[model samples]
Target: MSVSQTSGTDAVDLAIIRELSRNARISLAELGRRVSLSRPAVAERVRRLEDSGVIKGYGVHLDLDRLGLGLRAHVSLRPRLRSARKPQVLRDRLLAMGHVLSCVHVTGENCYELTIAVRDAQHLEQVIEQLSEMGDTTTGVVLSEPVHPRDVDIAAWLLCED
Candidate 1:
């Protein structure tokens, strides 16, 4: 596999990105007006951004509680043996599970960390049991989440000169 290199982004491109990040569904005319560009100019730039893989895609943020998934837990797995085969198999099994939202190969004492959401304690327990069957797992149920931002300040990081 080859990685494609992207051309350097200018101030105007950054401004356009900031505007789009604020509201992805904003009309091209409105966005161009905010960024002091014409609609066609903005459209062409957005098309380039998408083609160059700068703008991957757009997404919607949904509330887990509203979707009847109240219980959230973090499961840390420690493999019995440090073999490549068992770890890969365990990861594939976790990926197949519906309750496992995110699985991260992490550093430290644990091999993998999984973010899971379920309807209730019984459901969470079932997930835990399934995970335990694959390997030794330690689960921490989330009591509360203080901050979970959907969008981050990518413009600031991108603008900073290295």
Candidate 2:
């Protein structure tokens, strides 16, 4: 039988995802009991979720500061010339930089928003110089982050009625 037959897009899937999101190491038998499915069924569904790219992979969220990464900066960059080609080239270069954790193409005056984690001011300055070579960038160092949600609302995203 298809994996969906064992566990399809129903409340069961949501429960499995929620449980897995909380602790990816949870045993299949425990997950089965929580989601009202057999252990084998739960395993099949989880496998399918992985294959489908829904459950990408499990990872440990680290404390960057504890790991000696003392600086977090959000950089807004404006391309020297507004063109599709320029942004792609700039993005490629930014992605190669070790300090850049994430780079997102965004709207507004800036073409890209980069989330950079670095050792200190000197490292941050080097990253800024590299990015600024292609485009102008405004860097804002993070002072404090009160909250950052680890889990996304999967049910809301999956079952949007609109």
Candidate 3:
């Protein structure tokens, strides 16, 4: 399964992306073996993928409980009527704050959705306190994650036109 990063990406490039998405730490030799290419060939494709920005950076997903970040919450921010804060300004402020795992600009009544990981209720409250200053926030603590984020679908990607 190859997920091309760009329009002109070929099968080998997509295959390389797919394998790496499954296991980023997989050895070049192992990846080559799986994709039926030599180590050097696989390495070249990986390098090309990186250069084209298909693969951004390799990362490890940590267990929040183990990391002492046991509390998880989504804070939805709705723009207030007389507030002069622009979205970019709010974004910059959000970026500066700690405990914000992911922040995305969205549509509808809410302007942004923020994923927060904190140590406990008090810590989460502190984050909410800050969020409230930015805008009116509706915070929801995550109870259980039924489905975690995963790799992209390479086959579906291949079927699409740029």
* All candidates: CA RMSD (Å): 4.2, 4.7, 3.2
Ranking by TM-score: 3, 1, 2
For model 3, the local distance difference test gives 0.80
lDDT of 2 at 5: 45
Candidate 1: Cα lDDT at 69: 97
Instruction: Report the C-alpha displacement of residue 60, candidate 1, in angstroms.
Output: 2.3
Tell me the tens digit of each residue's lDDT in model 2 across 1-162.
433344356667877888888888889999999989999999999998899887899988789999889899999988785552375766667667777878788778887888999889998998889878777889999997876656575654555533
Q: How many backbone clashes does candidate 3 have?
A: 2
Best-performing candidate as measured by TM-score: 3
User: How good is model 2 by TM-score?
Assistant: 0.78
What does the lDDT read for residue 6 in candidate 3?
43
Q: Is candidate 2 or candidate 3 better by TM-score?
A: 3
Tens-digit per-residue lDDT, 5-106, candidate 3: 445587777677778878889999999999899999889888887887778999987787999999899989885634425766766677788788888888
Candidate 2: the clashing residue pairs are none
